[model samples]
Target: MRQGLTWFNIASLLLGFLFLYLPIALLIIYSFNESRLVTVWAGFSTKWYAEMLQNQGLLNAGWVTLKVAFTSSCFATVLGTMAGLIMSRFGSFHGRTLFSGMIYAPLVMPEVITGLSLLLMFVAVALDRGFVTVTLAHITFSMCYVAVVVQSRLAGFDRSIEEAAMDLGCPPGRTFFQITLPIIAPAVVAGWLLSFTLSLDDLVIASFTTGPGATTLPMKIYSQVRLGVTPEINAVCTILVGLVATGVLTASLITRRQEMRREAEERQAIANS
Candidate 1:
């Protein structure tokens, strides 16, 4: 019975993976098709990739997307890290519950509502709906995700080390930069990566906040998809998929290495003591 159950689990796992990744796999495969029609595979070719590179519109949109994602992720990481530190380390403060709720409200809020609110605020302030607007909108939503990730990491953090540093001559700011930051660096990095991914994948908020000459890759792809799905579109999507996959893999490897090094350092410290 146990053996039968194990086989069933394996089968279920395989099926789940297939269900999740099969469409992506098919898209990647078709990206190499020579035919312009995405569904009809004529012969293997890299022509679409070449065309994607030469297509100025797609290239410009991609550049814009990268800029927005990078900028928003950096800002989100900083703000989110600060918010996480406050919520986890400060214990109780006046209006802490209200503050926490505001920080996390975006997580459960509908994208449409968030986007609409941002749009109205921008309009009210007479802020142009361009790259700046989109970046701000992304930062607003993505920061919440970053905060959640950082807060989870900080929840079980050992405060003794920080207390010890404070007990010593280390000032709070210095200790955070020299000691606390290094220890929680992995979580911060993970949060930044998550924010980057969210910004890159976001379409709704971007659509509401963006204006002329500020088209993102998603908006471009969506517009093209409405007209038709071409081999060029497939190639572009494959490239995005590849970039995101590479980023995730690199982050995982870096996080793992940091963890191993930390473990080794702790072991050495214990041995010395």
Candidate 2:
């Protein structure tokens, strides 16, 4: 039996959405404000955006952030995918519990601790805190998220397909690349996206690990916010929000299309069988 939403449920949901989005709505609206004061709207203009474009520091920070995000997410995806495969497909192994726990620890660990620990580790290793350090730190933490996502997908995956492929003389590496990877590609892509977003949004760890001249967007925004909020900051934030939203929506649509195509092919196969 289907349970229809009641008035209370609808009201609660509306309140929740309003709580979440009202601030974002206000920020988007204020991004266009001509006044320097964020709350005091003098007029609407796109000068803030123009100003953002002209600000070389902000632009450089954005570029650095993109570089870190892309590099870290790619590395994280590769490492996390391997971890997920081992945890899901390799069965029990030595120190499995400890390994799994370590992988998940980052998810619940406080950022301050994680950042401080990474900073200390970098210092001890004599690694100059810079783009490489920041990227490494991001990969370390972000990989955990990817591992969890890929593991969840693997948990529900049908192993019979792989088994049948193996029975038909498909080598392990060949079967994984040809069959397993394709089926789980969506999840891997999602994991990469999740890692990318995390890397882009991270501030604390970056602050700890980054050296001079490697300022990321979040660090730049935080520095400016310490002084005061401005229409320019709002403009930057709005742009980031738009970018993240577009990326997420595009990924979702692609995943959905792939899933639908796979389902249709499966249905056709069933009919033929």
Candidate 3:
């Protein structure tokens, strides 16, 4: 029975990994495939990547996407860090629960509904559907992701440090800028990157809100894929995957270094005493 269970677990692990990886593997493989019919192997070639380089529309869309991502991430990080700080520091209040729900509501709410609602709100307010409007929509959802990341980081932080800074006659703003922000900087930065990635990847909401000449890379990819899938799209996907992997590796390394430094300092103090 134990042997049977072990086999079952091994099978499950393989199955789960395959399920998670097969599509991505296929996408990466397809990018190198020379055939226009993406499924059939027509010999490997780097022509599609070259094609991506030559396609001006795709390049323009990518630029737009980058702009939106950067702007949204910057605003989201600032707004979300503030929100997380407030939600944590203020603790319970008359409408704290409601505020918390509102902040997190986006994560659970249907994307289609959120998209439609934002579209309607824009229309109702007579806001023109353009790059600015799309950025606003992106920032709305991006900020929610930032809030989630910052909030989790805040959970692990001890409040005593800020109090100590204040007790030392530091101004409130000085305490935050000097102590709290540094402690929370990693989380804030991670949140910003997350927001940027989400903004770049978003299609459905962007589709609803984006106007003429405001095409994002995802929108361009989706439009092209609807007509026909190509290695160019696959190349773009591979690039995104590579970028995300790089970001994750960098963050992990930084966090590990910080942890090791803390441990070393603690050990040194212990040995000295």
Candidate 4:
């Protein structure tokens, strides 16, 4: 019965994965199709790939998206790491629970609501609704993910090492830079990458906040998709899938390295004892 149940579970999971990914797999395959129709197969060719590169509007949107994602990710990483450190280390502070709640509240909230709220806030503040404002909104949303990831890493962290360094004449700032930061560097890096991907993939928030001539890659794709996806879109989708797969593999390697290092530390401590 247990064996049967295990097989059933595996089949179920495989089916679910196929259901989710088959369309994406089809998109990647169709990207090389010579046919203009996405669903039809007309011999493999890289013509669409060249077309994607030559489209001026898409090129501009891609550049804008890159700028927004990079800037938002950097800012989110800084602010999120700080928030994670504070939440993990200073939980006893007054209204700590409230602050943490507020920080995470945005993550679960509906995207439409979050975008609307940001739009209203920008309007009320009289901030020019442009690239900078869109970038800021992305940072605000992306930071929550970074904080969540880094906070999970920090939760498993042993604070005694940092405390010991402080007691041994290392200043708090120095200890953080030298000891605490190094230990969780993998998570921090992962968080930053996550923030970047999330920002790049965003559409609703960027749509609500972006002004004239500030279309992001996702926005460009979305607008065109309504008119039916082109061969160029298939090519773009293939590239994005490749990027996501690469990011996942890189993150997995980093996680594996961190685990190995942790096991080595455990063995070393046992030997010392």
Flag the better candidate by TM-score, 2 or 3. Answer: 2
Best model per TM-score: 4
1 or 4: which has the higher TM-score?
4
For candidate 4, report its TM-score: 0.93
The model with the greater lDDT, 3 or 4, is 4
RMSD of 2: 2.6
Write the residue-wise lDDT of candidate 3 on 1-273 in tens digits: 665578779899999999999999999999999897888999989999999999999999989988988998899999999989888788897999898998999888888988899999999999989899899999998898788777876776767888998998999999999999998787888788778778877899999999988999889988998988878899988887776676656656655665565567668768998
Cα lDDT tens digits for candidate 2, 1-273:
248878888899999999999999999999999888899989989999999999999999999999999999999999999999989987888999999999999999999999999999999999988999999999999999889878877886778899999999999999999999998898899888888888888999899898998999989999999999988899999988887777677656755766676678668778998
Alpha-carbon lDDT of model 2: 0.90
Please provide, for model 4 over 194-218, each residue's C-alpha lDDT reduced to its tens digit, 9 standing for 90 to 100: 8888887889999999998789988
Per-residue CA lDDT of model 1 for 156-198, tens digit only, reads 5667898999999899899999988888888889888878888
Lowest summed lDDT across 10 adjacent residues in model 2 is found at: 250-259
Candidate 2 local lDDT, residue 152: 74
Q: For model 2, name the residue pairs that clash.
A: none
Instruction: List the candidate numbers ranked by lDDT, top first.
Output: 2, 1, 4, 3
C-alpha lDDT of residue 228 in model 1: 82
Candidate models: Cα lDDT each: 0.90, 0.90, 0.86, 0.89
